[model samples]
Target: MARQLRERAEQHTETHLTLRDLRHVCWDPVPGAVVYVCENPRVVEAAADAGMDAGLVCTSGNATTVVHTLLTALVEGGTRLYVRGDFDWAGVAMVERLLTRYPAQPWRMSAADYEQQVERARDRRTPLQPLEGRPQTASWDPELAPSMNSFGMAVHEESALDLLVQDLRQRP
Candidate 1:
């Protein structure tokens, strides 16, 4: 299922994973290896297109049970998770939940990253909509939520796609 998802993105690739399929799939991650997690699959697709031989996973929003299963297996094998998501209330909630489950390192879900993307979105004239719903604290970056609320901006992963792809490109 993971390999199938890694192929070129198609319009109809939003299928859910079954526990049976999850049980059979195996990725014996190297000890102390790093795996990248993102909310949007586009980030994964972009990284793959950049020829990144990376351990990447896409949660496709709130993350499914299959994602949790995959993450658990990777952590048990000593793989560190580096996660990123949309810079919004929902994004923060998702990150907080993941942090509670595993000792995952945050990727671009930082106050600095949020601020920079907010500026970039402005420069690009992209609509900076006010963060909706209740704001949630970032378990990884303490200041991220306050800063995001103050700025009233949400930075989606696409804004930092190139930077993430660069990280993947430079991976040894």
Candidate 2:
């Protein structure tokens, strides 16, 4: 399923816009529309398999030119963007980027959400290193980055997939 979504996302990129050209386009979701964002291919695949009734796009780990282009277009189109990613540093970074680049709503990517998931973690002893690139503030939720830093561990979005899907289903 992941592969299929990846392929689709890639194909979408081939015909649409490359990541480099993202800055030139605008990606705004329609009012009340939901656009799912993720760092992993599997999540994209699952969403695709479930039938993406809403606007959906995959970042495929880090915002590539294609991901940026699609997201920008959605924002310009006035579509509401919902982003979810690994709970780790990279995830936070990705969320930060999305929030900064696009007017996106937080999709369970919060400190409270992280705390709940942390309580459910199987192994909590291993401390995660801070994400290396330029750290960007999470404009939507300021406390998120700090909370992750305090916890010193990474959380993958897959861990919270059920919560995200349930939330998406409830949205009209």
Candidate 3:
């Protein structure tokens, strides 16, 4: 499946396929396929280096037009996306955007998950100002936003990666 996706992406690039054109290709279902959404290249690189077997795709931050096209293709093919990002407003916003675009399961981004991590947080930093925007209800788990607000700090997904990788390893 990964090879097929890579080939499709390469073909699309070589042919200069428009986003509209790429959108029409239905992706085959890759059950348990996981896509990591991150703003940082290191996260993507690390995931690759660690040989994480999920169908990983790097968002490179805000979804570029290409990333959007790729994700659309992946979702259409039945790939269930799992996202992780910085636990700030921007990260939340990115998750929201992807949720809007594709059907995705929250990857340890729930309120309960955050609470557990918060309890273990060392050298915790206070949330920065300009917290005016409302957080969206997590589609996979509704309590996530409220928990984040109540905690008054952002817990980046990277900080909880060990737990995430463990969960991934255990996925059927």
Best by lDDT: 1
Flag regions of model 1 displaced more than 4 Å.
1-18
Query: What is the lDDT of every predicted structure here?
Result: 0.81, 0.65, 0.63
For model 3, the superposed segments whose C-alpha errors exceed 4 Å read 1-36, 123-136
lDDT of 1 by residue, 1-172 (tens): 6577545333323345666777876665689998888899888778766667777788999988889988899899899998878998998899888888889878878899899989888898887677898989887778998898899877888878888899776754
Using TM-score as the yardstick, the better of models 1 and 2 is 1
Winner by lDDT between candidate 3 and candidate 1: 1
Question: Candidate 2 on 22-99: residue-level lDDT in tens?
Answer: 555333335656677767766655554555444456677898767776766666676778887887766777777777
Identify the superior model by TM-score, candidate 1 or candidate 3. Answer: 1
- Candidate 3 weakest ten by summed lDDT: 8-17
By summed lDDT, the worst window of 10 consecutive residues in model 2 runs over 12-21
- Judged by lDDT against the true structure, how good is candidate 1? 0.81
Query: RMSD of model 2, in Å?
Result: 6.2
Worst 10 residues of 1 by lDDT: 6-15
Q: Over the stretch 22-60, how does candidate 3's per-residue lDDT look in tens digits?
A: 666555667656665555555544554555554456676
Better of 1 and 2 by lDDT: 1
